[model samples]
Target: MYQLNLARSLAAGSVFGQNAVKCSQMLVSEGKLEPESFNIAIGVAAKMRGQANLRAFHEHYLEKTSEFRANKVVRRFQEAIDSLSIGSLGNILVEARTTRIRPTTRSTGLDEGVRL
Candidate 1:
């Protein structure tokens, strides 16, 4: 799946419309769209800060998933849209990048496991 923020960072918001359209058209049939891809496209709409794209995303996802799942998606999608619209995404992105990643560790009964 194409990363929505990648277009926002690498190109411009204008490009996101084309990406979202293409993604939606590719999954025109029901049962083709998955949660991850639907989420990303909706996120692109939010991050692009376009009302049309958001509507398109809403319609497209509704076609792909159930009402129950759609409700959950819509709630989270609204949150993302609100975050972007209100300019909180900048701080969120910075916070995300600045957060420290914990090292991964594997345990062995012999106490010879390594950390990475």
Candidate 2:
């Protein structure tokens, strides 16, 4: 559990990719293909452990629909957490980040056309 948070904080872009180019790049630099550890650390710094703990409860337990009982929700949360380790999540985050490209906007000159 702690490892997952630590990984999220250290990995870049909040994604992981098995075949991502970035992973390759990291491997080239560090001799192993892994998400950026520094970025994960940054994530941890940005969101401290206390805040994360509180958020987990709120997001996983309180935020669910009425049909979802608290215990059930908590069990689900535990399942999910157990399924993936922090390193895996960070890797996924890195992959997700790599795929995300800022949307490009082209000036249409519509505002210029409507002169004051």
- lDDT for model 2: 0.48
Flag regions of model 1 displaced more than 4 Å.
1-47, 50-53, 66-72, 83-85, 94-96, 110-116
What lDDT tens digits, residue by residue, belong to model 1 across residues 1-116?
Answer: 35534544554445655655554445544445655545445455446655556667677778999877777777777675665522344334324555589886656577675544
lDDT of 2 by residue, 39-100 (tens): 44333332333344544675665656553565576666556655655455555554664457
On the 0 to 100 scale, the lDDT of residue 32 in model 2 is 44
Measured over all alpha carbons after superposition, the RMSD of each candidate to the real structure, in angstroms, is 13.9, 11.7
Worst 10 residues of 2 by lDDT: 14-23
lDDT of 1: 0.55
Please, what is the TM-score per model? 0.35, 0.33
